[model samples]
Target: MTVNPGHTFARIAIVTVSDRASGGQYEDLSGPAVEQWLRRAVAQPCEFVRRIVPDGVESVRNALLQLCDKDDIDLVLTTGGTGPAPRDLTVEATHQVLTKELPGFGELMRRVSLEQVPTAILSRQTAGVRGRSLIINLPGKPASIGICLAAVFPAVPYCLELIGARKMAEALPDSGA
Candidate 1:
């Protein structure tokens, strides 16, 4: 698939996989938190496609398919559903859509989160590539979202470049893409 990253901005899809958030019981702080962090981490502008879905393999999976397929988002970042809970199904949904798994993103986020909380192991945050879209599952906590994203954020642009999601020189300020 040819991923069309616009010259003006990179496209991103933020999905919050939580029954509570999707049910309107609570606001989706995690999804917004991810968007906030990305705005600061990425130099280029971004076109964000956001979604709040209930915790279910099908719900999350369908959201992923819609974002990665029709939207052509360069990145799909999900928060929630990565825990050990029976309802946590983000990783499973992510796996359902991924063509290639990138173990290092999950490994590094877990390692980084482990430093702050011992229960980080219970978190199953993971990442992979589907076609040209990179999908990463992250923790639901607002505090941990930034920590986990920060741990893996530096490599995100490079990862996107390597996967042909974005052109190499668009990341380089002097390259004149």
Candidate 2:
């Protein structure tokens, strides 16, 4: 999973799960926001592969598998489909893809979000690891995506390391505090 040698950029997949976006009913703001955040935060070059999938377990699961297995991506950030609505199935899809569930990520995200809005408790956002790829589900709103990513991004490099992703240290600077 280490990015192949000689490559300066980390390969990342940004999956946006929204029926409307997938149907072309609206532009995907959250996915772009995730990419923007990565560009600013990583300090290293990143190859972001973006996907828009309808809100469904099968669609999300398929997209995730393809990104992690075929694309060999190091990280997958999924925005939208994380709420309690009838169509929100990002969590279920993530569970089907990841071998291990990282509950602490969700807990920390909700805790940080709770400070701003009491309804943050309703968010089902979570994170997990599929092979060497670390997948994190984020809220749909662009602003919320920024908030949640900032809260959890510092630990991403270490987590990817534990999952055996190579070349991460050079690509993702931790600036250990």
Judged by whole-model lDDT over C-alpha atoms, candidate 2 comes out at 0.86
Q: Please provide, for model 2 over 1-177, each residue's C-alpha lDDT reduced to its tens digit, 9 standing for 90 to 100.
A: 455566456788899999999999999998999988777777666788999999999999999999888787888999999899999999999999998889999999999999989999999988988888899999998978878987888789899878876444332445321
Count residue pairs with overlapping backbones in model 2: 1
* lDDT per residue (tens digit) for residues 1-177 in model 1: 875534346788899998989999988899888888776666666788899999999999999998888888888999999998999988998999999999999999999999999999998988999888899998999999989877787788888888888632223323221
Q: Model 1: residues >4 Å from true position, as ranges?
A: 5-8, 167-177
RMSD of 2: 3.1
In Å, residue 129's CA in model 1 sits off its true spot by 0.4
State the C-alpha lDDT per candidate: 0.85, 0.86
- Where in model 2 is the C-alpha error above 4 Å? 1-8, 169-177
Span of ten consecutive residues with least summed lDDT in model 1: 168-177
Can you list the residue pairs that collide in candidate 1? Answer: none
